[model samples]
Target: MGRGGVPRPTGRGVGVLAAGVLVVLVGWLLQAPALVFAGTTLVVLIVAVTISLLFRTADVRVTRRFTPDRGVAGWSAVETVAVLPRGGRTSGTVRVREQLPFGRLSDAEAAAVLLVPGRASSAVFRHHDLPRGRHRIGPLHVDLVESYGVARRRVVASGVAEFVVVPEVVEVGLGRESRALGDGSRRQREHSLAGGEDDPVTREYRRGDPMRRVHWKATARHGELMVRQEEQHGLPSARVVIAVAAEGWPDARPTLPPTSRVGVRAATAAIPLVSDAFEWAVSFAATVAVEVGHAGSATVLTTPGGTLVARHDPDSTTMFLDDLADLRLDDAPGAPAPAPSPREPVVAVVSGLGRPDLDLLVASRAPGSSAVAVVVTAALPLGAGLTSRPTRPADGRARADDRVLAPDEVAGALRDSGWRVVETDSSVDVGRLITTSGVLDD
Candidate 1:
């Protein structure tokens, strides 16, 4: 529950009621006639106690049901509240406040409603797009008031779960070809088959093969053991890795030098970009993964949509999106050694285009896995494709003067290491590039 939420009233409810009861009882007993005051006091005390006993409940359980469960960063996720009163039922005023995900701010649609005995009323809340990351909902506030608003009782609701606000997932074609050259092919060559992915052929079943796949017709015709053969599928059509090298990113000291501004801005914009980028990437990844099924890859084993992480897995997609939503400038993954594996696809999205360390990282990975570096600096060149976004700075050093790499340079470097580099024009919408690539648009 949020701050200023209604708190449960204890002494206020019984305290005022008891005091009035005592005063009346004494006045009746001490009066000369006695009967007049005594009769009135008895009636008042009985009524007060009766109402108190009726509303008294020790255990209250609060739960919420959310619709759709996941949505793009800009959309809303509606939820309903279920209130279960355990000890006893009461007819009185009930106030509730629900905590929203992340920095998401919320306003109540309806307020100050009465909760009748043994009945539960539902309320809906719309979550706005806050800064991206893994947002969680929790901390319900239950406030109970009695004795004509003289007092109130409050309790806290715990154990709320988290939801990820990812960039909208969109499709990016050719990403499979992009990734096939990296994470997938390496795993296949080491563990599965060794051939161009597009080749149309099937492999015989092995120890793990299911009886359902056994080719009875083939066995009958061949007079020997035979099983279904599966076709080979190509590499991932897309691979999206949002890399935030804190050291290579911005420290954001306004007093700092000109170069610092680039890092700060790029890093600061991570959630905004990541939120949208991953959302788009997931769909792109999944669409391509579907074809891999024909290629004999088990979901997760050989494809992004499969065992590794595919479109069919909402939970996995949610996880990837959430990680991006929560991303911030963390120190470089401890002075980046060789990546965990040669097949890992690393996409360096940074603010400073002139970072040499980042360039070295990309250059190093070119030999083992394809690498892509996206620079988002204002001083960097602009226009569509690399061929347009570069020029020599006043400093005039080819590699050092402030200049965004031309597409040719990027593509050349990536190709040299057997990777591919694609960039966006500053004039173009970054979101569009992400979406056209088949990532989320939201």
Candidate 2:
């Protein structure tokens, strides 16, 4: 059990045995009366030794190797603990366990390792679940007994390392590697992104841009119709609000509509729903920064670096990603979703969009009237018969429906809600969708 307190070798048994043997031999040689007592004591000592040996737990040693570093929200960890048996009492089974804080990897169970007899014949328990901090692999404890129902013993060993998890990033999808960053603030970006505002010089005009602000002096020098091309704003970085589908998040309590009966809903409860490399979202965010230049919108990230408000710079992508790598996954109370403001659009990385809450969010961003663009990152997250616009409830009273909508159907629903939905084949292709899903005209 619990160490039974620390172990310190006791020499009492050995001393007693030695004394009994010595007394017996000396007394018998001297023909003394005490020889009888000595002989009896020797027998008792032998019995004691037999009893102790019978109960001693099989000699066991443990060696544990673990990945010292962890990503954000470290619910899954990799640790291999091997148990080796020493000479005496060869083999026995042991429990390989880790102390996990409550609420981490709720789905995981404790591992019971079976140890086989012989040297180096051990059991390795990989994929140990640990929290986001240092964990002590206390001394190895082994409880064994050779003679059944007779006696038992405990053996322990020490020397364990620590695993640290920083943060988990939820990368958003952005299209062009050039458009890695979404629109950022112009003024802030100029000062922060363009080498402290001294990097770019006024240059000539181009076809697509407004012309009245042309630089006549520069035109004289360059002998061309030059326009005042002030420093291009910093890279384009778009901040997004990410959420697991309301019903899909681990802690979600699905309040099924009374209208529809609750049945077994086939929900994919794994990361990277359609394809692997869910890291695609992160790649898109980086791309946006490259294409559009910063709009300087205040970023609100769900993951560590997921949110951003500053202007984009050469290092913006790196900074954003580094921050993203810092987030950890936890099912704390889901925070209230924020309303999209006028500054820029809001992109949401969600699991399922067929839910009613999703529609309201998109509807909030009035089509053709607001700058907000709602990008829903989900893989078949809706029920069937999804409606684009908020159709009047069948009863004529306003009520959201309980229906399943395909991803393409959701795209159309978004359009009906006054949003332009850019549907992608894979949620991983968030970049392509966001780049093309900008404000669409009627």
On lDDT, the candidate that comes out on top is: 1
Residue-by-residue lDDT tens digits, candidate 2, 167-203: 3333432222322123344445455564543333566
lDDT of 1 by residue, 44-97 (tens): 654565445334543455667766565555566766676655435444557666
| TM-scores, all models, native as reference | 0.48, 0.39
Q: Which ten residues in a row have the lowest lDDT in candidate 1?
A: 301-310
Which number leads on TM-score? 1
- Model 1 compared with the native: what TM-score? 0.48
